[model samples]
Target: MEVSRIRYWLGVLLVFLAAFCFALKGVLIKLAYQYQIDALSLLTLRLLFALPFYIGIAVYQRKREPVAPLTLREWLWLFFLGITGYYLASYFNFIGLVYISASLERILLFTYPTFVLMMNAVSRKRGISRLQWGALALTYLGILIAFAPHIQFGNQHNVLLGAFWVILSGLVYAVYLVGSDSMIARVGSQRFTCYALIAATIPVFIHYLIRNGFALLNYPAPVYGLTTIMAVFVTVVPTFMIAEGIKRIGSANASLVASIGPVFTIVLASGLLGEKITALQLLGTAFVLAGVSLIGWKGKKM
Candidate 1:
């Protein structure tokens, strides 16, 4: 029991660390945008820097433990998850960040658990519980409260457009989350993460080639430096940490711990990017955190 308790807490810590790293993603991307890089180009650079590490890890894992070959269905699922999870979801997020505050971006993205709950209820052919209904109400109400201030007073030229993209990212990410659990169980977390990330990387490279070609490599030195940091610290490290954390403590618990992300991002954005935090934003964040925590708690209960 003691060993299990230690393992659980370790998983919680890993997830907390992963959330902090993820929170840095928005600030870094916002900083990169200062150099006038397009979303695709920036995302491409991030994956380009991250690709080698994932490949090296996959190779090392193979050498360390010769796993069975994956079935065609598994390969297909990996491709699907790769496209939706990292590629589309991240692309939308990057684009959205161009038009919204980093704090708002994180707040909107943090609503994915609501989408996940809805998706699960649909798939299971069951109605949502009363607790879930209340949670959903609080979550969306928080988004509305948080968003209203931005629309009225924020300087962003296209807050609605940005919110749309980020919300879409959250929706697609929910799909990825729903699909990934079974795959993770089947393939093992490390190998599944490596394969899924590699699968995501191919399309990013191809998109960059088709859209901007070699022009993306000519960014200012700081742009590359920022992206490299993003790749290593934000992308690679957190990806593995969350995967391993989920393996140890299950996704529900990991996600509950990760609820710290939006608040962390708000703080980081304020300090790093000069984004302001308002009373309304804080209240909305509280609502979102409460709703998400309730969902995770109820999920674990069920």
Candidate 2:
């Protein structure tokens, strides 16, 4: 019993760490750009470099626990989930990072819970209860509060684009989550993440060819270092951990726990980027939290 308890707590900790690393995605990417690597270049660097690590893990896992046949339909859906969620979403996010503060991007990316709810609606789930209703309301409100300070000062064009991309990214993530959840039932969580990364990388490489010819990829010492860290720490490790977390905990609980992601980003920005949390952002974050809280709190009621 104690062993199970310890494993559960360890999983929770790893998931939280995954969310924190993801929040740093923008920060590290922007820092890479300081040396002149563009979004296309950043994506290329991260995906290409991270590919070996992903493949290695996937290969190792497959050796231990062979995967059963996934029907043609499941394979198709997995491709869609990976391409849209990982490749397209990450590209959009990196583009947004070029224009916004990491803190703001983090706040926006955390909006995935709203999409998850909407996705559930698409499936005709039982129903959302009163507590969930209240939690959703607060979570959105918290999101608004958390980043109110930084949004106003940015260029209007950049701000609009930033909001657009980050929100889209969140939607893609929701789709990926729902799609991959089914796949996880067939394969173990670790295997799913391994396959997920490889599946996502297909379009990612294609994107590099059509959009960029690699001019943007050449980087100096600083950009190379930061992008490597971003790929390994932010992209590979944390992402795999989060996928496993989603499988261990239901998406509702996982999303709520993940909702706390922005708190770490805002606090980190204050120290490293010297960005201050604003009254409005704090309020938004509170709303987002409230909404997420309602989801779980409401779960207990029934």
Candidate 3:
């Protein structure tokens, strides 16, 4: 019993850390924009820095686990998941951030859990649980609450456009999550993540090469520094930590903890990027947190 309790708390800590690290991605991307880096270039740099780690992990896993070679079909599925989830989703979010405040982007992106739940229900051929439905409602309600004040004040067209991009990002990421479920089961999570990330880097490289050939070496030191931090601290570390958290506490609890990401991003954006935070936004954050908590609690009970 004591060991089980310890494992649970450890899982909670890992999830919290993962969420905190992931939250930094939005704020860091916003900061990178201050250097006049375009979304594509910034994204390329992030992937470039991240690629090495994924490659190393793949090599290590090859030696350590000695799994069977992935079939062409499995490889193709992983490639699809990687491109859709990490590459396209990231690309959309980064581009959207160019027009939207980090806070808005984070809030919009936080809707993925709802998408995930819906996808699970549809895939499993069952109606969503009432608690899950309620959680989704509360989560969206919170986002709308936070978003309402911004809609009233911001440039309407730009805000709407940015919202669309971020929403699309969330949708694509949901697809990735759904697709990844089976892949992660077939190959272990760590192995699947490493392989998928390596595959995702291909498009990023191609995009960057076509856009700005050999210009990667020309960035200022700060761009390199920021991208490195974004890649390592936010991308690599949090990806594996969240994976481990799922292994321990299960995906439901891990996702609930991750819901805190919006709040973290909002606070950081307010301080670092000078984004405004109103009472409505705080209330919205609370609603999102509560809704996610409900989902996690309900999942645990089940």
The candidate that achieves the highest lDDT relative to the unseen native structure: 1
lDDT of 2: 0.74
Candidate 1 stretches greater than 4 Å from native: none
lDDT of 1: 0.91
Query: lDDT by residue for model 2 over 1-302, one digit each (tens)?
Result: 89877767777877888888877777777677777667877887787778889899888987888878788888787778778777888888888877777777887887776677767756866576555566666666665555445465643346777778888888888778766767777887777777777888777777777877655445687777777888799888887788767666655566667767777887777777776667776677666666766665454444
TM-score computed on alpha carbons, candidate 2 = 0.88
The lDDT for every candidate, in the order shown, is 0.91, 0.74, 0.86
Instruction: Choose 2 or 3, whichever is better by lDDT.
Output: 3
lDDT-best of 1 and 2: 1
Screening candidate 3 with a backbone cut-off below 3 angstroms (N, C-alpha, C), the clashing residue pairs are none
TM-score for each of the candidates? 0.96, 0.88, 0.95
Worst 10 residues of 1 by lDDT: 184-193
